[model samples]
Target chain A: MKNEIKIFSPATVANVACGFDVLGFCLDTIGDEMVIRKTEENGIKITKIEGYDLPFEAEKNVAGVSALAMYNALQPDCGFEIEIYKKIKPGSGIGSSSASAAGSVFGMNELLGKPLNNTELTNFAMKGEALASKCEHADNLAPAIFGGFTLVKSACPLKVLELPTPPDLFATLIHPQIEVKTSESRAILPKEIPLENAITQWANVGSLVHGLHTSDYNLIKESLTDVVIEPYRKQLIPHFDDVKSAVLEAGALGCAISGSGPSIFALSKSEATAKAVQLSMQNAYSKSNIQFETYVSKINTQGIKTL
Target chain B: MKNEIKIFSPATVANVACGFDVLGFCLDTIGDEMVIRKTEENGIKITKIEGYDLPFEAEKNVAGVSALAMYNALQPDCGFEIEIYKKIKPGSGIGSSSASAAGSVFGMNELLGKPLNNTELTNFAMKGEALASKCEHADNLAPAIFGGFTLVKSACPLKVLELPTPPDLFATLIHPQIEVKTSESRAILPKEIPLENAITQWANVGSLVHGLHTSDYNLIKESLTDVVIEPYRKQLIPHFDDVKSAVLEAGALGCAISGSGPSIFALSKSEATAKAVQLSMQNAYSKSNIQFETYVSKINTQGIKTL
Candidate 1:
């Protein structure tokens, strides 16, 4: 039997505009890669790390914690060591932690003879995210694990559903060189929201899901509106309104702060439009004098996979 | 062109479980029938009414107001007269008022040579619902006018999207003989909802839409949970908890208060299970010594069709 495996777990955009805390999708580009090998050690070990500052202890690092979670669940006869080559940056709000967490568990599961189903693997991966953010959220982890569009139906029992994505859909991600702690961004939101706004938000969520299923670009445009969280979170981003307007004017279907903040994403009907939207958003942020990286990609259909 | 037309507008179950004010679907068994004919008079008229106490004035009754709105919108050289045979009971939380309103407008639109599309017809029908409830909401009217599953993407510009429904899915509606005014039930709800609960609610809404499109029964069962409106509205419906439990145990995919309240609806994988759920829900309420009527139906695929 093969005793080692290498896997790639993609970056994810959570919230997806109107679907705050519930929706996410995987990006074709940008991710974390991990190589796992069976070892004679007593427990999980993080033998190596690259390209980012993260804890090395098996219990503290996201990758080590995730591999430990899987290892403890399986109680495999053989121990394992994981080496993570991180590319997705931390605190980017593009599911950097999730990529690491999912990559570890996914790689471990493959090396362990695939004992866990995707859902169970996702549950184990979420522990790593919880360790990082102090909250167990699958919006990012689910997409990283399952790929395409994902919805976290419930957090308590951990039900995640993979939604259909249109073939023509493309995403543009602009990661500004700044940091917005997920915990702080979440804390800044009001504990209570007006019922009216919630209704509008849910309406948009329903429409967005419908649009993805039917490949209706107009429906996607109409449903991408967010009334509750965006109104509050926009204050943390520079020129949020102008950038959103610029993208929309440049033929982007919709644009919103990715996950929590510091990264903005726009969905477009064509790759060309997505590229155009990337330039428009970048230009809007130019006056702010902040460094940013832009990526245009088709949605990643295959999430975490062994190579 | 024919000067007269008769149409049947199906009763709708709005706010299906977790989708408050945004989702709805047509029921095949219950509806309102309306006959609209071009008139020489200067204004609209409600010439006949049956099976319900409704106003005769053109601007006051749901049927009259709906026909008037359509007539005024078209400004056809001829006015219109409507006759309504109301079968769906008022205050039953089954889109009773919406049926009359949608039926009148639907019949008038056909009589006027189909000048209005389904979306435009829903808009005119919403005016009638607004006249009755004092607020314009298309949750009920959109489904009654369009058919199958429907989502009101936005109310301001009146964007309505018809969603796909699973073919094997069936609905069981048990309407207990009690009065719960839509306005009063709405007024009882808190103006603001906890953000946590709203997030949960929207997640379920997203999953519910996903389930319907993919025909995944487990997803449907998981997504039908309600946290925002049902807790407060269930107080108005007797044995609400027991009845919901009974239906679920009887193989219902999910169950919740249909529309505003006093009517409980359950979804099942088959017509047989739907019938069983209907009986179970009715029996749960039997101990309370309350009268009730039950309906088991396949989702009406063709909404507001001519007889």
Candidate 2:
């Protein structure tokens, strides 16, 4: 058995337009890297944190917390140490914390001879997310751990389902250099939504799942509309409407706030259109004097893999 | 061009458990039939009605209204007369009105040399639904017209998407001899839904769509749970909980009130299980001294076809 392992977990876009808190997809370009090694001690330790300022305490850091959860579940006498290199920035609304959390558990699972399945790893990773966001949600963590498009059927038992993705599908992500606290963004949403809007939202979600399975571009385009959450969450993001309109005009199939806000993403049929969407979105934000970074990528078919 | 055509439109189960007003599916056993023949006159006439008492006027009856809509759209310089044979009774919550409405448009489309596509046909059929329920909704009408599992992406422009169905999937429908007014059932639901409940509902809807496409029975079972609509509508149906429990215990994958109520449907993996569910549900209702009819069928892949 391997005593040490290195793994990478991709970033995820949660909500996927109309499927708020239920749908997410992995990204190929941006993610977090974790190196996990078995140690003589009986607990988890965080040896290093790079690329971003994050907690080093095993219990406090997301990656370390996830690793510890996996270790405890295995009940192995040996301890583990985790080193995280974060590429996905926190509060970008692109599942930064989830990559760290999922990567840690995934790496530990490999080092321990694969004691847990992907769903169980996702469950442990969700605990890490709970530590960060004050709630346990698998929308981001499931995709980060399982790859591709993922649907969280239920969070209680943590049923994660992998969905089909068209081979030609591409994504454009624009991360503005701003922070929209996930908790604050969530708090801004209404506790109750009009029953009609709820119906529309579920309709879009069902259509989106159907579109992904069938690789129907027109269906995806029609299903990307958000009538419930986006109308409320977009207020926290700067230039939300202008950037969305620009991306749509630039031939993007759909655009929406990535998760909570401060970051936006668009899906396209080809890499060329995705690049054009990136340029259009960047220009829109620049016109408003907002600094942002853009990444264009194909949908990540491999969620977490060995490095 | 053929001057006369006959078509059959399948019965539909809307809501599909968790996807209220968004998802629906067709059944093989129950439906409505219409015969349309072009006439020298300039409009539409409902010359006959059978199996149920419905308005004979072109504008008042669902079938006649739908046929008139198709006639107006074609402007074929000819009138059409329709004869309706309804097997799916109205107020059964099994999409009786939708069957007549969809059947009328489908038959007229055939008589007019296919002037309109399925979406356009669905639009006219929705007008028929509006005549009965006073609201233009197509959850039932789309599936009745299109066949198989369907997702209504949007209602304004009438975007309908057909989803894949598993080959072995069977349905058991136990329609008690009772009437649950669609309008009143809808009115009983709250105008606003809790945001948390909405999230659960959409998650289930997304999963159900994924399950049907991928043929994952467990996923379908998990996704059939309803936390938003059924809790409110079940009260209108007598012994709803007992019937549901009985069906589930009898090897059904999932069970719920069909459409708005008075009819209950269960999904199973095999024909035998479906029949078993039918018996269990019928027995449960019998104990309550309620009269009902039962049907066991494979999913109707052919939504509207000539007999």
Go through the candidates in order and give each one's DockQ. 0.87, 0.88
Per residue, candidate 1 scores C-alpha lDDT tens digits across B257-304 of: 999978989999999999899889878988888899999989998888
TM-score of 2: 0.96
Q: Which 10-residue window of candidate 1 chain A scores lowest in summed lDDT?
A: A105-114
- Candidate 2, residues A1-307, lDDT tens digits: the string is 8999888778889999998988999998888888888899889988988999998988898887777777777888788888888888888888988998898888878887787899999999988998889999998998888889998888988888899998889999999898888878988899999998998888888888888888989788878988998888898888899999999999999999898877899999999999999999888988776688999989998898898
Instruction: Give per-residue CA lDDT, model 2, range B164-258, as digits (tens).
Output: 88898999998889878888898899999999999999989988988888888988988898899888999999988998999999999999989
Clashing pairs in 1: none
Give the per-residue Cα lDDT of candidate 2 at B292. Answer: 88
Off by over 4 Å in 2: B1-3
Among all windows of 10 consecutive residues in model 2 chain B, the one with the lowest summed lDDT is B66-75
Q: Which ten residues in a row have the lowest lDDT in candidate 1 chain B?
A: B65-74
Instruction: Single out the weakest 10-residue window by summed lDDT for candidate 2 chain A.
Output: A64-73
lDDT for each residue of candidate 1 in A1-307, tens digit (9 for 90 to 100) = 7889888879999999999999999998788888888897768888889989788898999878888888887898888888889899999989999999888888877877788888998898889999989988899999999999998888778888888889989999888898787777988999999999999998888888988898888889988988999998988888889989999999999999999988999999999999999899889988888888889999998998787
